[model samples]
Target: MIPFSLLDYVALFWYITFWLCFSWVVDHSRLKHHNLSHLMNGHRLRWMRNMSTRDLRMVDTAIISGLQNGTAFFASTSLLAIGGGFAMLNSTERAIQLFSDLSIPVETTRALWEVKVLFLILIYVYAFFKFGWAYRLFNYSSILIGALPYAKTADEQELEIAIRQAAEFNSLAGKHFNLGLRSFFFSLALFGWFVHPGLLIVTTTFVGLVLIRRQYFSRSQTLSMHLLPEKE
Candidate 1:
């Protein structure tokens, strides 16, 4: 095992800490008024409200089905990625030789390479769990939608309660799905660590900046805000 240098340890620590802080800031911080997530949350609520008024709920069900399908797809992809990671671990000798031939100056022993591959596997495992749970939450949201009283029979208050319940579950599912996607993005950045600690720090910082921009300043956020109804 090639023992990790102090710099390697520091790089790994910073990568994990930054990821956690970034996720918390994006999901919990309300400093921004019209970030991508906030805008989508508003739309989720509006969608529930619109469904409450409709007699035919096929559209709402179809949307929920779509969400479930997307989550399932990602979960399956994560599983495949995990299997590939194991396959790479079994061929570490060839991988190390390939990196050497490519002139990548990474100082990796067999044990260290295995550890790196294991780290990658753990990341995909985390994503798979997140995606799987999100799929289940979407299913629960669908059931909630179905349980909602028919438009003709439901009182306004009853409809409001059902809509709120369904919307909350839908929002929670979306949050988990987003987290899974974020893991996928960060995994790409993690590949830099296999090259060098310095490169890892640089890639991590770059990825963080890109994610922050997409969340708060992207054109999609602008378009979503534009679609919102104006206040009186």
Candidate 2:
């Protein structure tokens, strides 16, 4: 078995640290208001509120249907990825043999390759559960949407509570879906571990930076900001 090195441990730790910190900052920190998720969440709240005012809500239901379809797609993709990971484990010996013949220096130890494959499987498992739960949340949100009374007949306070519930469920579903996508991004970084621990660090950092940029500084964020009527 190829023994794990101290640098490998450090790289894994850094990957976890960055993922956790980035998630917290994006979801809970004061700076979150500046993130695209926060902006989109406001949109969600508005959508639920506006939905209450409408008697013909086919459009709103259609939007929820779209969201559910997207979440189900991701959930299915995560399952496929997990199956692929297990297949990789089954082929580790052949994979190591194939890599050893390559000119580039590659770590070709069976145990090390197995460990990497197992970690990849675990990441996919995490993502699958996240997506699964997100799909359920979206389902619940749709039910809540149907429960929403026409604004013309609803008591103001009761309608406010119902709208909030629908919006919160929708937002929560989106949050979990984003997290599953984050796992997908980090799983790409996990690919670097197949070559070298140092490369793992480099790839993880690149993924983290890309996520930050897209959330906080990308042109998409600018477009999202334009959708909001006022600053959060």
Highest-scoring model, lDDT: 2
Worst 10 residues of 1 by lDDT: 29-38
Which pairs of residues clash in candidate 1, taking residues 3 or more apart in a chain or in different chains? none
Cα lDDT of model 1 by residue, 69-108, tens digit: 9999999999999999999899999988887887557677
The TM-scores of all predictions, comma-separated, are 0.93, 0.96
Candidate 2 C-alpha lDDT tens digits along 1-232 = 4578898898889988988999999999999998998889988988988899999999999999999999899999999999999999999889998889989898757888888899999999999999999999999999999999899998999999999899999999999999999999999998998988899999999999999999999998999888886633
After TM-score superposition, what is the CA distance of residue 221 in candidate 1 from its true location, in Å? Answer: 1.0
Please list the Cα RMSD from the true structure of every candidate, rounded to 1 decimal place: 1.9, 1.5
Q: Backbone collision count in every prediction?
A: 0, 0
- For candidate 2, the lDDT comes to 0.92
lDDT of each: 0.88, 0.92
Backbone-clash count (model 2): 0
